[model samples]
Target: MSVTYLEAIREAQAYLLEHDSRVYIYGQDVGAFGGAFKATKHLANRFPGRVIDAPISEDAMIGSAVGAAIEGMRPIIEIQFADFSTVGLNQVVNQAATLFWRTETPCPITLRLPSGGTSGGGPFHSQCLESIYAHFPGLVVCTPATVEDAYSMLIESVTLDDPVIFCEHKYLYYHLKAESLPKDALPLGKARIARAGRDCTVVTYSAMLHECLEAAEEMSAEGIELEVVDLRTVKPLDTDTIIASVARTGRLLCAAEGWPWGGVNAEVISRVVAEGFNLLDAPPQRINAKDTPIPYHPKLWSVHRPAAASIMAAVRNVLRS
Candidate 1:
């Protein structure tokens, strides 16, 4: 049976709860309501007290999780949506993120953010905040693009000593699938070459990876082979793999679902220009969502985010440069 990206996440959480007594899930409606997306469906019944729900306050939820982590409990917090996480930004970026650095105590907390855009989700519900969270020093921001990465990276995040921002794309929850759960996975912070090519390199993560792959296939028909790199974690970026990919292709294009200003794509291009200037045959470019709040209308939203057509156009521009 094919396991979807959402299922892999649930399985990973189940595995963590079953094996680790210190691991518990905390969020609003996470206990019985099964989360806004049902990622924790029936988990409360299986784990009982371990999957307890919290009040609607995001700040309170994060604060409690941070406290739990400091006391040796590994807390997995499920924020209802990525945008809502801003309500508890202080606890996340200041408290949980700096806990270990300040007190030399490992704060092992996994903050699961249901990220990315979905139809009619609008500005409040549809947001990709990975770049914002990744800007922090101590947070490990993971953006899993596939089912296997979704499962393994989450498990790995809880096991780590630092705080983790698990940005599981909302759009990929049911759309992406795998043949089975992963027994072994690439280490976190490693970039995978989703599709290898020599004409150009496309560095992307989360739901954007699939868009890049589609663009790559279209370019291949025109005899242009675009190398697609899936960045599993935005923070602790795998610069080595990215530079190596650029070394071979000599042209780079970074794509993301977030806005254009100082985002993950911007960072990718900045690193390439700064560290591997000699590897470029052309100027690095990036594509992101327009600098405006996400629209509610489906037609407008369709053109608002980067898609295969836009990605292909960007690739063509990079090739010409």
Candidate 2:
């Protein structure tokens, strides 16, 4: 049976609640209202005291989750919109990120950020800030591409000793679907190749992975084969798999839902260039959202972000170069 991306996320939450008594979820409208995306729909009724609805203050919600994690509870805190995470920067960066450094208290707090564009959420609602969390040392940032990974990574994230920024793409919430997920899963730090090829390597995650896959299939018909590597875990990135792919194809292109300046692509391109610079026919390229906020109207939305055509152009440029 096929399961949508939202269903996979719901499964992950339900599994955590059933498997671990210490695992609790707190966010805006996450309980009775079942969250803005309804990923937690009916979960409040299922887990009476566990699925809590917090106030609109992201700072307070993160602070509460941090305190709970310190006291031996695995708290999964949702920021509602990834854009609103700016208000809770202190709790995320200074407090939750440095809890172990300050003392021996392991903050097993999972910050679930519903991020990325494509929903016409404007500047105030949609944004990809995973790179901001990646700047910190103690946080484990993850953005799974497939349904199976979305289902399993959430479980693995809650079990981690450090804080994790679990980024869920709003664009991919229900767009992606897969037949029954695997009962057993891989570790959190691994990357998966959605499509194998001997040509250029297209590194992407979240909603952009689907675009890359579509572009790759289209490009394949034109005799330009491209391998798609989904970086499931963004923070502790699987550099080994990335470098190996680059070594095989001798070229790489990164497509992320983040801004062009100082995003995950910069970090990934830097690592590849520093370690695997020799394994390139041309300098690595990236297809990222423009360095601006997402617009509201559908007409202006196309100008703010990268699309399949943009990614295909980049891949073709790599091939031509």
Candidate 3:
């Protein structure tokens, strides 16, 4: 009786709709078509008028949701892909982000991004925009890896005052599962230590967390312990936990599915060197997707993003240094 990451998300939305009348679902084909990924399957029928579909315009979808949120409604806008969310950048960054500060009215909007690269998705459909949205002032960026967090975090997101970027990895929708939905979860902005070790630290989130865990387990066979930390939410990153983990491990390796430049990996490495430089025995390293657009070919896509083999190689490098 395992619940998948996709199912967990559907359940979470169902819970929100049942519990909170203020909550509603809005996005392309979400009402009758059940969304492109079927994340909203049967939701339109169950919730009738509440689950409404919007025009094809991403900017308009977000703009209306932002306005609805400001008027005391909590709207969840589902972007078909994380890459497509860029179309609504102005509404997200300019309107939803600063509404609370500029007008004193909380804009509680949750933007669900079907994020991360999958085989055949290519560059247009595959992208990790968590780091980009996290850069904004009034946005809370969440990268949920586990089914538990997927269910719990989304429910929490719509309730918050600030706009939330929900980065749900497309790769994990069916691949990751749990025995039961979580009743309660680690609060947003808290990092979870997935595995404990003293040799080195691998800080990661979302789908990359699973890959890092696999690498850590493989390295254990060689007596090279790798501590794995899962940063549940990227914005308001839990630096205290990350710094403390590096202090114990004496080495750091930041990993993410996004590109290396100005991404979560860069931020983690920068923080460690800036705040916990004395604790490290070697220079902090980071593993990221190659600096190129995601390719359509399976072979090319396989190597484009960080994988277990790549992460293992990275840990071995940290150990050597």
Candidate 4:
């Protein structure tokens, strides 16, 4: 059955709840009102005691999740908007992320963040803040692009012993669909090659994966065989996959929905420069959000994001360079 991004998330929650007794979910409006985006709609009714409504405090919610995980309970905490997670930075970096490396204790909290721009949510609600969490050690970060991936990897995140920041692109909630999940669902700590080609490799994740795929199709018409790599997991990056793919294509472009400066693309490019520099036919290029707050105006919003046209242009430029 074809599914939306919202449904994919609900399915994942159901799967986790049924598979493990220790797993539970809670966040703002998650109980009686469903979620702000209705991703967790009907979960409270279906699971009863398992789905909880949280008070209006991101820091408190995260702190409670950290404590729950430490006591052998698997908990998933959702920050209503990715921007709200700023209120919980102390719990994420200083607490949850450091527990393992500091005291040899396990933290299995899953921090689910709905991020990205496109809904005219303005600067506050539409920020893509995965780069902030990626900067910290001992935290695994993931952003899924497809509905199947959205379902599978979420289940995978629940089984991991480490804390994870799972960033779901809000713009993609209903923008794409897929028939069904793979029988052998994708595991954490791995990347998927979305489209295979011998020309240039377009490395991206989350909402930008759709842009890169569209660009790849457009590039095909112009005789440019583009390979698209969905770096499913940003933290604990699968650099080996990136290096090998770049080695085959001899050119690389890292695209993301976040701002260009210190974005995930920066890390991807740095990895290429560090390990795959010898395989590059040209310097790595980046097609990312313009270095500014996400504008509220529709026209300006269009210009602020990295679209297929921009990615295609970058591919052509890199090929000629």
Q: Per-prediction RMSD in angstroms?
A: 0.7, 1.1, 0.7, 1.1
Score candidate 1 by TM-score against the native.
0.99
lDDT of 1 by residue, 70-139 (tens): 8999999999998999999999999998888888998899999999899999999999999999999899
Please identify model 2 stretches exceeding 4 Å from their true place. none
lDDT of each: 0.94, 0.89, 0.93, 0.89
Residues 43-153 of candidate 3 have per-residue lDDT tens digits of: 989898989988889999999999898789999999989999999999999999999989899999999999999889999999998989988899999999999999999
TM-score of each: 0.99, 0.97, 0.99, 0.97
Q: Which residue segments of model 3 deviate by more than 4 Å?
A: none
Tens digit per residue, CA lDDT, model 4, 117-201: 9657888888988889999998999998888888888888888999999999988898678786556766887999999999999
Among the numbered candidates, top lDDT falls to 1
Model 4, residue pairs in steric clash: none
Worst 10 residues of 2 by lDDT: 298-307
